[model samples]
Target: MKKFNLFKEIIITDRNVLTEAINSGKLFGIRVDGNICYEPFTLDDILIYRGTPDASLPIETIFGKNYQVLEDNDRVLIKAFSNWQEIIGFNSPRATYDDTTADGVDEFSTKEMENIGWHASEFNIKYRTLVDVLEDKCEGTLICIEQEEPYQFSGLGFIDDLADARDVLFEYCQREIQRLINEDEDYAQDNLNDDELEAAEFFKI
Candidate 1:
């Protein structure tokens, strides 16, 4: 549940240089069996560079919208949603004022509750939500989704399906953790009660 470190994985889900990038360090490297391995590293390699034979492109620009890059080099700001346009408004004073009151004292009077109100001023700007940007754009598109995740000491988290790619990566980490624990010859005596150890031994074989 806790990620030790964050790593940006620029995954190429197609037949592109993603694999070569991993293999060559021009893209990324992952852990395997507790060891940092590069591309061409098989599942057994701990640092695996696995993928399909197709390549996908980045959605720098959407069909009808343009994204503004943010201070964060990898992040961008999105103004409009799928169908909704952002609007704003401004508050101003009215032309006429009413001085008649119960105490005969002058008070503030405004038109339309304020001098001027704009729909645009009323609305606020928005950036694409993380889920929206990543999910919507990369859903079924055969492209490489790039984002950061936990770092691994060994066992690569290479995946093909960019959508469920995190699941694949996490699975790799879990398996690697289990492998290391299982490989520890002293693991049996280091932890676990007699009953748990007995059950583990029964299942170990």
Candidate 2:
């Protein structure tokens, strides 16, 4: 219910909006295309050397309209999710936001990533950031499909069979519906209990 100190996520349903956000300097570390460029993001790497594959690259360049990113939580961002164009999902401690309120800011940037514990990208720039993902030309895509849920993503993928994809996504939708029903039941139960308590207090029995 409450995402305290967590990176909020939203599912992107429109590519046009994604392009608009990225072009407006509203995103970074994007992995939309079929290539892998690491940062639209930053890193506090130990040593920027060949020994470490910690070099950064800009991403989200060659997104195919027919593709669909899959759900991935089994791997870390640097492993499966953070590729040139292929995408999975990510996990770790929560982290986002810009550096507007920080002590000072630079002209080209918000100095936002500096407030970092760890960072992630958003579908909307209006959402609070954990770190700056828009390091270069690349930026990740996120969108708000529902008001209650924020950060739940599978990955960036191409839609192979449109019909099949729809069916699969429908399953996801049904699952979400069940979750909503369960949540509503919980709230209703809680309210009923509260009413019962209030009635007991009034009766003084």
Largest TM-score belongs to which candidate? 2
Give the residue spans of candidate 2 off by over 4 A. 1-156, 183-205
Each prediction's whole-model lDDT (CA) = 0.26, 0.26
RMSD of 2: 19.3
lDDT of 2 by residue, 30-69 (tens): 3322222233233221100111111131223122332223
Model 2 is weakest, by summed lDDT over 10 consecutive residues, at 45-54
- Predicted model with the maximum lDDT: 1
1-205, model 1: which lDDT tens digit per residue? 1111112222222223233543442334322122333444332331222222222424233213322212224323222212111110000021122111233212212222121111111111111121222233332211111233552121112222332533432333334334544775544346655544443343332
Q: Which regions of candidate 1 are displaced past 4 Å?
A: 1-163, 186-189, 192-205
